[model samples]
Target: MAKEYEFTQIIKDHEGVIFKITTIYTNNHEDQKDLYQEIVYQLWKSFDNFRGDSKISTWMYRVGLNTAITRLKKEKRKGNQIGIDQVIMKQTDQYDTEFEERLKILYAHIHGLNELEKGLMLLLLEGKKYEEIASITGLSPSNVGTRISRIKQKLKTQIVKK
Candidate 1:
């Protein structure tokens, strides 16, 4: 359908969201790449049901995050050891190698967070509305607001230390 084509185009234009979500959920490079592919595949599968009820990006966050969560669950069950270099980092322009290393350290800390905190921060960084984050993450609006506030303070402290 034309809608599906447009949706694919939109995803291609804004690929960073997928990358960010993958980075947020995965501990290592291989898992990141797998999660990124799973997000893309889920998005494509869900395209026909989009219905334009929400912003495409909001819908995408929902699908991608859900897919990542499910994949994490599956990995836990299978005892999989996702390799670091399995990720194809061949296209990281502008972000230098040092920045990537620092980002990996940051991501490692982020991966230590509980699932709710991780989801909250990921959507917050993606600029989703509080209501939208609640819709996707199943938190009350006020709870989402409080959590985001705390997360910001925590991130500030961490950044100050570094």
Candidate 2:
């Protein structure tokens, strides 16, 4: 019972992280919800083995990302699905039209990146420090930095060409 409570609280505290990951990895609402549930399920399955060696958020990212990547691979093996034409933007009135358009463009470019680059860019966009990203991704901090630099330049070039 106590274990369930603890796990529930952890999920509540970090639900946004899960949502962001799901949104980044999935193209539509149904897929996003499926991925979100899968991530939570995987997290719960491994809850007993969590040793507190890392921040819970880091652990969650590691598990969530690995699960998402694995699912994507499985999906590819099952053959291609039709791509959705509409981008999934959060429905918020706070942003002006121009900012929203730019955000859409940004996400489109992000979706074009390779899987590893997509994960790295997602972590960077979440404002995680290099060391945290490195820990979550199993990459050296310097490699994270180098990859991010390349990703930024790639995004810049792509956006410019658009």
Candidate 3:
């Protein structure tokens, strides 16, 4: 019961992280739902081992990214190229046409990023600090900064080409 409660609390607090990671890795609604379930299961399985060494959200991000990467690689081995054409981010009621166009372009460039780059961008987009992103991604803080700079430039170039 205690573990169940803990898992429930984690889910309530960090479910958005799971969904966002799933969206970044998956191309369709069905795959997104499946990846979300897999992430939740992994979190539950490892919940007992969580030692409070990091924030729960941080731990969740690490686990979520690892699971998504593993799943993606496995699918790749099976010759699957999941194209992310489905728009997961809904336009708000007050959004202008300009915002919508920018959003589409953003998603396009995001889809062009590799798996590791996608993870980094997702973490950055979630407003994680450099240290936190480095910890989750097993990179040095300086490396995180450098990589983010490069990623931004790449994204700029991609959007410019469109």
lDDT of 3 by residue, 1-162 (tens): 987987798797776788789878877666776677778889988988898999988999999999998874334233343443232344565489999888767777788999889999999999999999999999999999999999999988876886
Alpha carbon lDDT at 73, candidate 3: 33
Candidate 1: C-alpha lDDT? 0.77
CA lDDT, every prediction? 0.77, 0.84, 0.82
1 against 3, candidate with superior lDDT: 3
Model 2, residue 80: distance off in Å is 23
Which stretches of model 2 miss by more than 4 angstroms?
72-99
- Give the best candidate by TM-score: 2
Which candidate leads the pack in lDDT?
A: 2
**lDDT score for residue 112 of model 1:** 61
Q: Write the per-residue lDDT of candidate 1 for residues 61-150, one digit (tens) a residue.
A: 888888888874445433443452434455366488988797778776687677778999888766878998998888899999999888
Question: RMSD per prediction, one decimal?
Answer: 4.6, 5.2, 5.2
Q: What TM-scores do the predictions have? A: 0.74, 0.84, 0.82
Candidate 2 lDDT over residue span 33-121, tens digit each: 66777798999999999989889998999999998899843343333333321323355555888888887777798898998999999
Poorest 10 consecutive residues of model 1 by lDDT?
A: 77-86
Q: Report how far off residue 35 is in candidate 2 (Å).
A: 0.2
lDDT of 1 at 126: 68
